[model samples]
Target: MYSLLQRLRSLRHGFWYGVSRRIRWSRGAFEEAPARELCNVDPEPAERIAALRDRYQVQFELGMSAATSRNNYEYLDLLDRGWSSLGIGRPSGGVLCDIGCASFWYAATLQAFFQPDRLLGVEVEGHRLFRDGRARIDYAAGYLWRLPNAEFVVADYTRCLLPADLITCWFAFLTPAAILAWRLPLSLLAPERLFPRIRHNLRPVGLFFMVNHGPAEAALAEGLCAAAGLRRAGRWSSPAALSRYRMLPSVLSWWRAG
Candidate 1:
């Protein structure tokens, strides 16, 4: 009975995935504008928040809702702390690619943190709750419309990618259990292929940054990077506080392409 139920769920998800792709293609060009009202700030120390704002020039507002705004701020904080701890400095104008960027919740934070001349968010899944309603791609594009250099693409990272000066993958699914939990097709779980592609697309000396759920996943990811011949740059366990929710402390790691 359990096997049968799992099969049924997979079929349902597969059917919807095909339908969503067709709908997305038929929708014509996607158009978006900057969110009208950008008003939400983190309640961190005044000086710290101000310093971040001054450095990144990011307001950390999604303009979608207060909840999303707050979430963005939290991500911004995480990125700042993680990158600083790793001894990675902000990059000048260059290309950046973020893999597994579902809904691109941190699109603004990434744009501000890296200050990339071109920011591309790549995701394999573009599922929608309803056929006619908005999809994950819609949310990403809308949220990033304010940043002229930021764009999102629905594609498999293992199959295709543009060369980039910097690459980031946040909480990528490393185990089969993680993929099933997200209801993604099992075929999409291809760390072996994904890591190689990431290394190939990274320009020489370019940075590849990743964040994992905890020490276990971090170890798995580190091994993959090593197999791909990426030189380990730095690793740190983020200690930033995410007051909105509870979870295991995140582990951050970065590698440089030879």
Candidate 2:
């Protein structure tokens, strides 16, 4: 009698399990729409677009945000207090180039913040977002074409270009200083090889904003630039939202020899 009762319980569980599996299977059986009906494509442009589909799916996030601009604003606000002491004036319509500019958010903020006349943004990746001719900021997408005014290059980043009144290489450009604390070779070699080319592109008192994603990077940037004769114009840091919001990242901008 005990064995018979046990057999009946197993049967009951198995029956319900089978029924659940069938329901799930029924819900999951779906068919894709026909290609001709679902897609609107012409023969020529459609084929050209298809070739670009693979290229359009790339993404890079530099962890910059409006909060960063807010932080910049606050720092400037503080600086305003000591403008006389520092002998500083508001940044004017100077040509600025953002090397390794991703998404161009900070680039736009730069124009809004400092009111520079021409802003040059160079990134290795496709400039899908910033390339529209209608974009308020003058932008050239998909090329590292040299411009007489100011130039930004996306490749290797070791090459030289036109001089600038000010140059900003945000977090991405400067490696974390902590990395150097651990690895001295990179700390010593990289910044030196890259400096002469960069220094060659600066005016007598041109400003360089080397923003690093880490504190250690800030130290490295200072050391490297000082070694290369780029004096420090000003140094300050503000709390960043990247520490709060998960997606955002922060860096220290080492304004060199302005």
Regions of candidate 2 where Cα sits further than 4 Å from its true position: 1-87, 125-153, 173-189, 240-243, 246-258
Error of 2 at 69 (Å): 10
Model 1 agreement with the true structure over 1-258: per-residue lDDT tens digits: 236666676666667677777767433223343353444434554456566668778665434564565566666777788777766576657999999898787787887777789999998885444355667766776677778888888898999858999999988998866876787656677899999999999998688988888798899999999999898888877556553364677888888985
lDDT of 2 by residue, 1-258 (tens): 225544455455445434433442212111212122213434553343333223322111112233343333333333332232445564567777666664344443455445566777655432222122222112332111222333444343456475777777765444423323322123222556566556667666677766555466677667777777677776655543223332333444445552
Best by TM-score: 1
Query: Among all windows of ten consecutive residues in candidate 1, which has the lowest summed lDDT?
Result: 25-34
Question: Each candidate's TM vs. the true structure?
Answer: 0.84, 0.49
Give the TM-score (vs. native) of candidate 2.
Answer: 0.49
Minimal lDDT window, size 10, model 2 = 25-34
Please report how far candidate 2 places residue 142 from its true position, in Å: 12
Note the Cα lDDT for every prediction shown. 0.75, 0.45
Model 2 local distance difference test score: 0.45
Candidate 1: RMSD to truth: 3.5
Distance from true location, Cα of 130 in model 1, Å? 4.7
